[model samples]
Target: MTVNDGTATGTTHGSMADAELVSTEVLLAKPKRVVREDLKMPDGRVIDWYFMDTPDSVMVVPLTNDGRLVFVRQYRHNLKKHCIELPAGAVSAGEDPAEAALRELEEETGYRLAEGEELVSLGRFYSLPSETNKYTNFYFARVTWDHEPILDNEIEAYFDMSVVTIPAADVFSRLAGEINGMETAGALMLSQRYIAAA
Candidate 1:
């Protein structure tokens, strides 16, 4: 038998099927998914693995005409704290990641790219290979805060998010200290390389 582990698209062989689920539990299901599986390992060992099978997400490294980056300061329940992060959201089923990046930018920061402006593709990466199948695509866009963005006020009752701006020249140091979200930090790093070459 072959088991793909549902991580990537391809065929699996040999020991891949050795880890058969003995028991399963669903912890969360919705905008996000969390599940636990008890698998019997190849060496006749059994272990439990918790996984978050979430949709792929997009992170926008949005910049303004004045060389400032747009960010979101939102309260994260799991962390029990507010985090400064890039404007990001999940890619809806069958939706393009580039489109998702643009949508998330406007929804979260009220910033839309000016006419003819385009998004620079940074890259994509796995959030946590060991625990989650969630990967994030990074994008860089120059935005014009010219119009008001009609946003969902109750997107998440406790997750109230506010827009924040930081000078592009000062982003790295800030990320090193104040911005703790790894996804945000990774997006910034990827954007920096692109900005430098352009």
Candidate 2:
């Protein structure tokens, strides 16, 4: 599943290449990469401020034994507010997303899944792709588990999380508008599609 779907991607007010053009050199250098702040315009090509590198990220939507979801609530300083988010983590170099999700589910929420029920790939984030070539893969998985808190390998602080036992019908009531992340919203929409078809 993907957002904007290309047909609407280019037609929309935003550019569709999902790729940003960076045409600067030797501004600054970092440990794993360099900093290229000068970007070029498409036609004549100009110079602007844009970072040359960033880390890949990942997020997850997890379901537990009692048919409830496991989400995390944390104070996102960047947003200067708190958010309700699904269990998520980063995909380390050379790590399979399925394995990463499993490890992350426990590490972030302390729920070791018994087995994964279904896996859904939501495609790449191409976040500000027009600016960088970084495309991080995001995914969703429905899993069943008997949760017993494992303090040693869990988030240090818990903000607010509930095993939301809402029916599937209720999931989409908040889509296409006020839902948080696009990836989660998209994957849940895909989940609804798969659920309806079956």
Which digits, one per residue and each the tens of the lDDT, describe model 2 over residues 1-198? 236654432333333133356555655564335556544443444556555465566666665445455566556656776655666666677888767777777666666644636566766565666555555565556665556434332433544343333444455675544357665665565445544432
For this target, which candidate reaches the highest TM-score against the unseen true structure? Answer: 1
Local lDDT at 95 for model 2: 85
Cα-based lDDT for every prediction? 0.83, 0.56
What TM-score would every model get versus the actual structure? 0.82, 0.61
Pairs of colliding residues, candidate 1: none
| Cα-based lDDT at residue 189, candidate 1 | 84
State, as a TM-score between 0 and 1, how close model 2 is to the true structure.
Answer: 0.61
Give candidate 1's total backbone clashes: 0
Cα RMSD of predicted structure 1: 6.0
lDDT of 1: 0.83
